[model samples]
Target: MFDTWSVRELANADHPPSVPLNPMGALPCIARLEDETGSSWWVAATANRWTTTHVLVLWRPDPRNHRQERLVWLRKADVRPWLHKEQATRT
Candidate 1:
C-alpha cells in the first residue's frame, strides 16, 4: 500500500504519531515517493533520528558513475505515492 498525497496536502494535514526506530536506531521503512515535479524516487529513512523533517533518497546514477550510489535529502512533505492510470486499472 502507498500513501497518496501531495506535498501541499501533507503540509496542511496532521502528522501521524512518531514511529519508533529499530534497535540499530534507524527508521526501517522504504517508500516510493513522487514529487510535485512528477519525478519518482525510492527513499529510505536516514540514520539521523534527531528530526522527522527529511529523508535520504538514492539518486538516479549517471552512466559514468554507475559504481557510485548518490544519496540526497528531501523534505518529508514532498514524498507521496507514485500513482499511474495503469496501476489504478489493475487494482
Candidate 2:
C-alpha cells in the first residue's frame, strides 16, 4: 500500500496533531525514516500518540550485540513509505 506521494504525505506533512495512545492491535506499516543526524532507517509504525512531532516505531533488535531494542518515536516528516524509492531503483 505504498503511495508515490510518500505514503499519504507523511514525508511532506507538517507536525502531526497530538493523539491518544492506542497500544492494542496497532496497525503497523513499513516506512523509511531519516533521523536528526540524517541517518536512514527502516522502521515499522506502532503507535502515534508518543508525540505530536513523532510517530512510535517498533524498533528491531540489534543483531550485532544481541541487545534488546526499545520502541522509538521518529519525526513524522522523516518517515516515507518503504517502497517510495521503488521507482528510482527500477530505472
Question: Top TM-score: which candidate number?
Answer: 2
| Superposed Cα deviation of residue 32, candidate 1 (Å) | 13
Give candidate 1 regions above 4 Å deviation.
Answer: 1-52, 61-65, 84-86
lDDT of 1 by residue, 1-91 (tens): 3333233322222233553353334343444545456655554422323237655444323324546543444456544444456755763
lDDT for residue 16 in candidate 1, whole number 0-100: 33
* Top of the candidates by lDDT: 2
Candidate 1 TM-score to native: 0.30
- Looking at model 2, report the run of 10 residues with the lowest lDDT sum: 1-10
Pairs clashing in candidate 1? none
Local distance difference test, per candidate? 0.42, 0.47
Q: On a 0 to 1 TM-score scale, where does candidate 2 land against the true structure? A: 0.38
C-alpha TM-score for every candidate: 0.30, 0.38
